[model samples]
Target: MSGDHSTYAPRSGFTKWIDTRLPLPRLMHDSFVSYPVPRNLNYAYTFGGILSIMLGLQMLTGIVLAMHYVASTDQAFTSVEFIMRDVNYGWLLRYLHANGASFFFLAVYLHIARGLYYGSYKAPRELLWILGVVILFLMMGTAFMGYVLPWGQMSFWGATVITGFFSAFPAVGDWIQRLLIGGFAVGQPTLNRFYSLHYLLPFMIAGVVILHIWALHVTGQTNPTGVDIRKKTDTIPFTPYATIKDALGMSVFFLVFAYFVFYMPNYLGHADNYIEANSLKTPAEIVPEWYFLPFYAMLRAITFNLGPINSKLGGVLTMFASILVLFVVPWLDTSKVRSAVYRPVYKVCFWLFIVDCLLLGWCGSQPPQGAIVLTAQLGTLYYFGFFLIIMPLLGLVEKPRRLPNSITEAVLSRRQTSAGRPAGATAAPEDRG
Candidate 1:
């Protein structure tokens, strides 16, 4: 697929000269305009395009926010207030940027879940998956840094708490923590550094996104049936077809985003953030943004010590390991079948895993006491076990149902069944081994 060159022809002498030099237009045409996509892809496939739009929106809004944003400890919170009240349309920009983060995460989570459901991370696309995980990590860092820019109560304490996580390391933990904050605590230096990094990481994410797309084009997209595209009938050009669908999906997404931005701008933010940072006082309950809650729950779930490892360090490691484990998922799930659609047993386990994650997120949001703590511990265990144990074991023991011969076959069979017509003969049996 990577070798599939653009068939674009220059229409003018100037265009021909540029095409010979850069071929930039040609690359765009090949990647998006004339790209061949599986005809059977569902709405889930549209999230990728939606996410791209969100990233662009974020970068554009963030740049404008930074123009008026004061990153100093003394003026940061007031600057945000100024943006809301004094600056022209600054309230709109700030709200859009803030809420855009949530929308971006929402789209990305769905995109990742879609990938997991269809085995988009399997062989020949492992690097594509890894690049995606890299983008995720970068996004988390950028968001965390951006959150600290407000320098409000939660912003200050959240920074203090999260940066202190580095102190969980055995010997050099303290040193690392000090380095991160640039002082003894979350102060002017910390705010300055976060501001600088917040500005930098998104562009880095964009760079990696380019690589992710390149890798995607190389391997081509995986379909619902988990079968490779073998014929022209299995795919369609991306222009008009896929592009139109993506445009519609993006329009619907922006409608929801606009509602939140206009009517419920502060809906996703903490009320405590309205108050300025107070080094002397801390909120009774410190919580992260909703998106980070699941991993945060995992971090707080470690209440007991194991051997030489203390609970603090263990929790930190567990929280990070949860994300790190995704890097090796392609190898961990031994099943040759990519999509869960044909893998009944795997489908059940997949939903259970999703539930476990939600439980952990809920646990993270609540106080870690009594039932919540126990549930979080259980959920965390299951989260790891799903990837480490169940995925591998299921691949070896469970039988996947028959897969369609091609993407076209899967689409037609579904259509035939929906129309109350008999589907064509099934393909030959696939090797279980």
Candidate 2:
């Protein structure tokens, strides 16, 4: 039974109290009622929700771990050990934080890929995708710095190698390097700064993600079918529909996460990090985490160091640019069609881009040997070309096949006709190869 609006007036007591303090109704309306989200937003859209939940997990587990962590280089390694040995349920926090980073990235990359596939970055949704890019950069920076806080060998050298990328800029290269390291090298001062920054960046990511959500909310979500939402008939309330999809998606994602936690938690970790940090000694193969490897490979691809230009700053700039180039993807992609399925030329380039990234990642882990250097050069060229050259070209030259008139038609046509199931109705994903 519903209350009679004619007999009701504005609340004066507990309703007012809750409205002023929590504003639950307003939040519910904004999130579920007023928002007109697409009906066909498949599994990909759930990644953004999963990412939001994982960020909360990271913050909680990180805070608890930080309580046991010593920022000092002298005790940082021992503190990790002490947590393992002394603190109650410390391993849970540590495992959660470490694997949580991987899961966060997993969700983000999927979210971005979803955007890429759906043309979610075009026009009104451009700012949302851009915000996601910025959030990505923040996540990378946060992860890089956080890896160093453990005061392990891989942590130290990985920090050195990655921070060294900043020197790619002219003039202030050395100064930036010293500032980052807090001296000429990674030591106690570097550990302290990294610790402080690592703690601070998650909050920064949260702030950016708020902007990301706002941007996404303004334009709503993109679906796999690249259909547009124009009227109430074309859309559904964001709640029960999108919420259920998000819930299911998170459940699947957590299954993958649980597998990592239970079976291969340390599979993502480096062995050298088991050792304590030492300024005097360095690991023979001090590679950054797998996520940073592609960019790292890009930096090493450039062999000639030009004085201070060739210093740590140059390395830093090259590395940062590797991902920074991503922010401009919407501009680079010239095709009018948003879906990769529609663009034959674009789809092939997409796979090449994936290959280039994997090759670059592989080469980054190798020493700067003769063959590896050559391979890195090829991969680097392809990497830049994928975005800078191919994407722009595909936009101009490629002809997009006819697209569906609307999202509803696209979703309906897939089901069937009264005549019977047409060819490819309820079809499996074609092997685009």
TM-score of each: 0.96, 0.89
Query: Per-residue lDDT for 1-433 in model 1, tens only?
Result: 3236466878999989998899888888889888888888778889989988889999998998899999899999999999999999999999999999999999989899988899999999999999999999999999998999999999999999999999999999999999999999889999999999999999999999999999998888898888999998998988988899999999999999999999999999999999999999989999999899999999999999989999999999999999999999999999989999999999999999888888899999998899999999999999999999998999999999998888888888888787653222343346222
- Report the alpha-carbon TM-score of model 1 versus the true structure: 0.96
Clashing pairs in 1: none
lDDT of 2 by residue, 1-433 (tens): 1111112223678766776777665555666555677776778778888999999999999999989999988899999989877899887778888989988887887777677767778777778888888899889889988899888999888888666655555678778888999988788888898889999999999999888887777676777666667555667766678788889999988998999987897898898899987768878887888877888888888776666565344555666677888888878787778888788888788778777888998998898799998898899888888889988987899988788788788767765563354444555658222
lDDT at 202 for candidate 1? 96
State which candidate has the highest TM-score.
Answer: 1
lDDT agreement with native, every candidate = 0.92, 0.80
In model 2, the Cα lDDT at residue 104 comes to 88
Model 1 Cα displacement at 414 (Å)? 1.6
